[model samples]
Target: MASCTNWAAHKLVHAWLLAALLVTLLTLSPSLSAPACGVLATVEHPVEAGRPLRLLVVGDWGRKGRYNQSRVAQQMGKVAEAMNNIDFVVSTGDNFLDDGLASVDDRAFHESFVDVYTAESLRKQWYLVLGNHDYRGDVLAQIDPALRSIDSRFFCMRSFVVKAGTVDFFFVDTTPFQLKYWTDPGEDHYDWREVAPREAYIEHLLETRRYNYLDTLGIRLNSGSATELTWKVAVGHHTMRSVSAHGDTQELLQLLLPVLKDNGVDLYINGHDHCLEHISSRDSPIQYLTSGAGSKAWRGIFQPNEDKLEFFYDGQGFMSLEVDAGLAHAVFYDIDGQALHNRSLSKSNRQHVDQAPSLVSQE
Candidate 1:
């Protein structure tokens, strides 16, 4: 019986090794520079004394080929191995490059996502949102609903409120305002309506308003008693304020920042511009973090008036946050989890602040 068990273990090892080799081969291929891997990160940290909820947050990922997207996946695997409590992943949009999810079961999403975050825990749940790219690609609803059917944990267009000790999480989708194909209107070949609903420039501005900032905060505050543990976090993909090519998410910020200040949401996490940044908004004391360096890194634009900007780097890497009562911490690293930069948020500071995270190229 022992020998039979040993044989099974050996087969499993061989299968994993084969998978690794396949990934490496894809990475080495010149044509498939990006190949296929999960651009979303996988991490584990016990936020409280209860169930550990490790979250993988990313944006502007899914380039299938081109850049170091595969390296990001390899590094995230290391993070998964280090923690036992991680159960799910979340993203801010731009799930695929250019735009759209392939057909519902198209192997691309899984190949790029599922296989990349191949960790047992990461496969558990994946909550997604729209990015301008998704709108350009096609109706993401088709794939989103199907993924949920396969696993109820894919909380697309849904809210996730889970507690890990003292911390409360508000996982949100921030893809509505992402302008589809605006990055390059010339390359678009399909009807604009195919992806996101067609909205005139002005109407789009009003319709694609950022999430009602105060409303979400109010929901959170109301969801949990004022006496509930203090660490409250809000996350999405677009930047509330930044100097990157994406510019500042002004409208969204106007609605959200004031509320974040009023409610004291601990941290603002996003990944629209692909870089590593921990910016403190002069507008408020909130800490804004950008960890979208999964597949590629974008060059950052530093501004002189950017008050309270703590740290910013256009490097290739990922981030892991360790929160357990009392303190909430963040560590940014290369694909391997090596410490690049670090910071912690006071219980009061984390509740709310205005300011944010990303740049697209590392050049």
Candidate 2:
């Protein structure tokens, strides 16, 4: 009996050792065993204890507060207050419909945004990017800080970074990256008032050292920030990969995806296809989230790819995210505030982490 007990103890020790080794290997291997993509630049936003970060994401929603936009906003308020603290809101772009804002004083601003999202909880800062529809109007007017003076909530920039707590949100101007918009308009009308001569925009992205500089900065910031590395997220108006009506944005896949992949980004959020979707690629663990169902939805207009698609809802709705040090939770809410789907990710289970022993518990 004594000999048998000793043998069992030895077997258990070996089993634990093997499990540890497997965990180490998994942590080192990039998701799908792919190479890392970009150099991460960190933005410093300290998260306070007991105060988790929360965000409301919407897109393609500017329509003079008509349709489902008002209903979505109302639900957002209820969700925000329930979450206790919502840091801010994120507009995945297409902020205006049909045509972009004509001027800083464009009444569409009030009608579409100001008047629609009247919930006191939603009065916080709104980080915005430009979409194709927005580029159809005056691009310069949308980013003008003067709009903030009129209403403190409107915050739009071509490309900027917002760091809160241990997360860095990189907002990129994806509309200008697509060449077809400039080379071929066909029947569509584009204002090009401030975004004219297209070459300048393209050159800035390809030739200039702007993005490269950010890459270096991200590396340093991520290394030195707080105790653990901060999570990185890239926000654009278009998607790198999707199974929606728009399919995939080729330009973004080629130019931007590598950067996001290399920087170990956790999520890429966008809104061009007018639907809510979640996609996960085996080649990389970066999640592609779409929340463009603010005002209108494409109903069943989607081409489903089982390999890439995780969840998809064909209706008008919005998305909410709550982030903490150990986990990130996401949920989709319909226009009537009904919870449809929810997903959660633990930090230890992240594909980019160095070790993931706790992932076993998550399973």
Candidate 3:
């Protein structure tokens, strides 16, 4: 009877110890207990005072060089070579295809990403977000810091900010905002480990507190008396306004668009429809750009929305942006290394002056 009593006491002690350990972990890492959207990691990419910040944006790409992904990459390399000093590349999302990485050791990472974008100019840092397809596989594997060991250029997170000179790029995680992913995800299984109770997660991510840092940065810039023009660009995997097959993501239009408009976001860039597009907002000055044609493209999928469609190309292509203190210019390039359309916006004293987009002749 004494031995039994001692064993019971020992088991109870172990239980208490385990509970304490869990509490300690939660205390040490608040992220384990709850998502803290305000604490997103910021990556700084400095630019020279007089030079304009240049970058190439691609999405819906990773397919092991298949589906004309390699061809598009070749054109991207050519464009980067012409620019000569491309800063970095922004991958809107869907880094992997139908599903995401099965594991950190998945060969698709090398076959699709490493072996594919093989250009001297394409060796710069890559900032990426997670698409809905990414959630279908090991979501943790893609964002795992360990993957950096394989390629230092790989920098991805749930949602983060990249501050480059006058532009502050806000990369948002938009997959969780969709209701169908949780309620009607037909045979597909999404790895929503850290993002359960979607409402709280979305609320925290879109909270104004998360954007206070940008406001502070703006104040600092304005303190110099030289009327510095600050630009805010938001990137995500889902589209707010599009004329392609996927059209508009209603979830983002309702929940995320208002916050972006309120925060003075100048451009919302996304990739999901596997086509290149540009749409102008009627209510706000915000411009919507899509560069999802990194791989396969829809040939004849067109669905008009309420907004003004500036440009639309139902073929494989990518987009490039060059931003300075006053002017921001964007160009869309097709798989044949031809410029299809171009647009420019000039700002003075913090007011945007929109320029009409012109079609580039294929000659």
Q: Which candidate has the highest TM-score of all?
A: 3
Q: Each candidate's lDDT (Cα)?
A: 0.54, 0.71, 0.77
Q: Provide TM-scores for the models.
A: 0.69, 0.79, 0.82
Off by over 4 Å in 2: 1-48, 191-227, 305-307, 351-363
RMSD of each: 15.1, 16.6, 9.3
Worst window of 10 by summed lDDT in candidate 2:
354-363
Q: Model 3, 52-75: lDDT tens per residue?
A: 999999999999999999999998
Model 2: per-residue Cα lDDT over 195-241, one tens digit each: 45556445544674333324433553355543454666788898777
Flag regions of model 3 displaced more than 4 Å: 1-37, 199-228, 349-363
Give model 2's TM-score versus the native structure.
Answer: 0.79
Q: What TM-score would candidate 1 get against the native?
A: 0.69
Residue 312 lDDT (model 2)? 87
C-alpha lDDT (0 to 100) for residue 274 of candidate 3: 94
